[model samples]
Target: MTLRADAVGHAFDGEPVFSNVSLAVDPGEVVAVIGPSGAGKTTLLRFLALFERPDEGTVSFDGTDVWDAPESDRLGLRRRVGIVFQEAGLFDADVARNVEYGLRVRRPWSERLGDELAGLLGRNGTNGAVREALDLVGLADDADRSAASLSGGEAQRVSFARAVAYEPDVLLLDEPTSDLDPRNTAVIEDAVDRACDRGIGAVLATHDMNQARRVADRVAVLLDGGVIEVGPAERVFGSPDDERARKFVAGELVY
Candidate 1:
């Protein structure tokens, strides 16, 4: 499977964010997008998640143009793409339930109704998927804890768990571990690797150049409203064709 952006551009309230941007990911590959703040990394992921339409270009899935598809088809495609925003937007519920939210939403309405009926009969419990997701983020022992009681790092891990619970074909993460400690950051990175091992493609947007160099199979450098360079991670970091990308990778460029 493939999720791709072709010369895509977006504008916010008549202000252009980026233009002529192109990127793509296939199953089992991790593509990292790195840039300064407000360089449109999140906006680009939004387009990939089908939350926003680009003002000038195309976002496609498996070679089919996403926006041109019917709403039903688009919704189906959207469900197949999972996203973790920069913020941890957890619900006011138990940790397991927060992680289970994505799985529940992706379920068929009829299946959800059956679950509701089961809950009425006192048969409700978190599923194996929820437990597995929690385990992936080292939250298996915290399943029963209230989300509100968790620390910021724990909350972020829960958010990551929730996004990956459904095993979406495409994963989009925006600075997923920006606030976590090293241990927690390692956990998140390992989980990402496992997801890719399962043949799930991912797009990671991060500011940590070292993390990008470590985890990304390929890298895209976004600068001055567009992608200045993108290629295999080594080439992009070691010997970028664009002077801006070279400086950015060398720690000489600052936002």
Candidate 2:
């Protein structure tokens, strides 16, 4: 399913964060959001995920108005949309339990959820689906380990697994590789590719221009809480349309 925000706008405490922001993400496409801090990247993502309401505009998922739906309907909408926050979102429970949380939440009637997730995690086989997700993020052998036991990178990978386990149509990522080493970064990069292969639309927010160049099929540069330029990744980075994008991409501005 495709996710889109039409003429989105938001404000907080009488201050305008963003207005008239519009973007669409098609299934199997990877879109990267790049901008300095306080550029409304997080706000926009939260709006798309239906975590926050935009004062104006609408968020549509698969041609349905997700934000305009009732609270009861939003829960089902969330099942098809998964979010990976900058801070790893693992729980204190076991690794398998954390990944199975979304599945159980959406399908409470399933009696074999535990066994199903265990099998999916590859508890009995060498290629458990959970393990594959972890492996994709370079945490190949940490199933039974506690969430607190993982490093920043490992925890992030686990969070990725949890999101992937839901088989969402739209995957939203916020600074997914902010605290990772080179190897783990590569794992995240690969995971993004795999998600696209599975026809999952993705929107990633990052400060890393190089990473965006490597992964984003399309890039949107935000400044002062509005999209200054959005285009093919190569063109956006190689020939920025605005000074904010140019300065940030060139490392002249730090925000």
Candidate 3:
């Protein structure tokens, strides 16, 4: 599957935030969106996530234009896309329940059946999927812990687990590890790698150039709400054709 943004533009309250921005994420590919703060990286990710309809152009998933589709189709499409915001955004529940929230809401009957089957089989059963996600983030033992009791890093891990448990076709991440320490950041980065390993496309918005180098197959540089450079990570960072992108990559330019 492919998630694509075709010449997307957006404005707010008569003020334009960005225009004519286009990018695509192929299945199993990790695309890093790097830019200065206020350059509309989050806005662009919002558009790609189908959270907002762009004022111009379209966001498509698997060859279907999301905005023009029927409501049911849009909803169904959204179910296959997951988003992880900068904040952990966990509910006031235990870790396991928080991880289960998406599946419970989107697949209520299946969730119930999974629980029932798990109990009958004296195992986690399909709900073991939740445990699997927790395990991915190294939180398998924290499943019964109260989310409110979690540290910031743990909360973020739970949030990631929640998103991954659903096995979305596309994962949209907005500065997911910005607030994390090196250890926590490494954990989150590993989770992202696992997602891509499973053929889930990822679009990560981050200011960490090191992260882009480590994780991205391709990089798109956003400047003044437009994409100024886009190509393989090596070329974009090592030999960018755009002067602005070069400065940004060299740390000579501040956002």
Candidate 4:
């Protein structure tokens, strides 16, 4: 599935966050939204993930304008997208349990019912997706640890593992690796690659130009309350058509 925003605009109270920003992420593609602080990257991701409604324009899933559709349709669209915030908003549970909760919520009701029945029938009921997800995030050994006990990087990795366990159609990651060490950063990047390989589109919002360069297939530059440029990663970083984008990527522009 694809997630695209067309002329989308949003604001907080009386102040505008962004306006007329258009961007798209195709299946198996990784799109990066890069800008300085207060550029509304997180707000845009929230709208695309179906958590926040846009004030204008549309955020579409595949060919369907989810916001224009019914509330039920909006919920369905939300089920197909996973979001990781700048903060790791994990539940008060152990690592394995947290990941399992993420997976269980996204499963079909029939499958979940079957698992419940299997438990009553004394069956294992699971195929180890949670363990595999933890392993992917390099937190296999910390499965029994509480979320409160994890370090900053470890908590972030656990959050990533939780969101990725169900393999949603789109991943909305907001500064996912901002506080991570290099090793932990690679773990998250590799997990993103694995998900993209399975035809899951990903939107990574970050101010880190190098991180965008390392992970993006396409790049969208948000500035002055709008997307100033959108193009292939090479073109956006190497030779952008927009002057603001050019200076922003070159580190010569100050916010």
Candidate 5:
């Protein structure tokens, strides 16, 4: 599936945050959104995720307009998309439960009941899925640990695991590694690679040009609330078509 945002625009209190933004994420491809702070990267991601409807333009999944769809259809579409915010946003629960939360809530009632029964009988009880997700983030052994007891990086990994556990068609990440150190950043990057290998389309909003180079198949540069350049990662970073994009890439531009 492909997620496309066509000429999206948004404003707050009569002030435009961004305008005429457009991009797309194709299945199995990773598109990195790189921009300075307050450049509307998060806003663009929100529109793509269907969490917010742009005041102008449309977000379409496989040519179906998300905003025009019914609530149930929208919800269904949302279920197929996973998002990890800037913060971990974990609940006060153990790692396994936190990771299992999305699956439990999104599964059909009968399926949920079956999993609950399996839990009561002491069978795998969704632990298999939970463990697999935790493993993906290098936290398999921390499944029983409390989320509150983990480090900042660990917490973020758990948050990522929770998103990954859903096996979504699309993954949206907003500065997931911003607060992480080098090692944790690598771990998160590896998880993203794994997701893409599984054919899940991803849109990552990050300020780190190097990370964009490593993870993105294509790069979209946002400046002053609009995408100034978008193309193959190497081309966009090495020889951007827009003068502003060139400046931004050369570290000559600052937000």
Candidate 6:
């Protein structure tokens, strides 16, 4: 799916966070939003996810204006968009349940599909898709484990699996690697690449330029509440045209 933000702007209590911000995520593309802390990266992602309304612009998904769509259509549209938060956001349930959470939310009887679901659950009785999703994220072996028992890395993997299990057209990730070690970070990054391979467009909001360089096809640098520069990842990081972009790349504080 394509996510297009046309001059989107939002604020809280009259304090402007950003204005006239435009962004787009095309099929099979991963666009990274890099900025300093408190630069409105999360806010932008929230707007894209329809969790927040833009006070001064529009957010469109797959050629449909989300803000203008009917309630039923909006609900359907939301089902096709997935958001991976900074934290794993898993419940107290087991690993399998966590991975299949989104599917259960969308289609309560999804387990009635076939043996694949049963296999995921370690038996042919039922509840197998949960296990399959966990397996997809390398957490299959932990299907019976509790969410609270997982390490930060493992929990994040479960979160990724859950988001993808629903097969959303667009994935909005906010600081996806913030709480993981390098190894786990790499695991999640690879999953993200695989998501794009499956024709899911992604918008990742991150504070790490190195991670952006490693995963992003294009990068948009947000400074002082607006997009200062956007282009190929290499050019944005290696040869920025704007001074703000250059300073951000050089490790100086832009805020």
Q: Best candidate per TM-score, number?
A: 5
- Locate the minimum summed-lDDT window of 10 residues in model 3: 117-126
**lDDT of every predicted structure (CA atoms):** 0.89, 0.82, 0.89, 0.87, 0.89, 0.85
In model 3, where do residues sit more than 4 Å from their true spots?
110-126
Cα-based TM-score, every candidate: 0.93, 0.88, 0.93, 0.93, 0.94, 0.91
Off-target runs (Cα >4 Å) in candidate 4 are 108-127
- TM-score head-to-head 2 vs 4, winner: 4
Cα lDDT of model 6 by residue, 1-255, tens digit: 688999998888999998999999998899999998888999999888888689999999867899899988887777878889999889999877777668767544444555566456443332566665566677778888999998999999999888887778899999989989998999899889988998999999998889999999999998987999999999999999999899988898646
Off by over 4 Å in 5: 108-124
lDDT of 4: 0.87
Stretch of 10 with least lDDT, candidate 6:
118-127
**Local accuracy of candidate 4 as per-residue lDDT tens digits, 1-255:** 889999999888979999999998999999999999999998899888888789998989888999779987777788899888778888898888888777767754345567567566331233377778788888888888999998888889888888888878999999999888998888899888888998889999998899899999999999999999999999999999999999999998997
With a 3 Å backbone cut-off (N, CA, C), the pairs that clash in candidate 4 are none
Residues 1-255, model 2: lDDT tens digits: 889999999889989998899999999999999888888999999988888779999999877898668888887787778888888878997776676666556444243455666456443432355666666666667778888888888788888888886578899999989878988888888998998898999999999888999999999988877888899998887888798878777888866
What is the model-wide C-alpha lDDT for candidate 5? 0.89
| 1-255 per-residue lDDT for model 1 (tens digits) | 899999999888998899999999999999999999999999999899999899999999989999999998898899989888878999999998888788778754345457566466331444677888888888999989999999888888899899888889999999998988998889889889998999999999999999998899999999999999999999999999999999998989767
Error of 3 at 37 (Å): 0.8
Off-target runs (Cα >4 Å) in candidate 2 are 107-129
Model 6 lDDT on a 0 to 1 scale: 0.85
lDDT of each residue in 12-90, candidate 5, tens digit only: 8899988998899988999999989888888889888888889999999999999899998988888888899989999
Q: Give one digit per residue, the lDDT tens place, for model 3 in 1-255.
A: 899999988898989888899999998999999999988999998888788899999899878999889998898888878889999989898898899886656545444566566457542444687899999999999888999999999899999989888788999999999999999899999999998999999999999999999999999999977999999999999999999999999999964
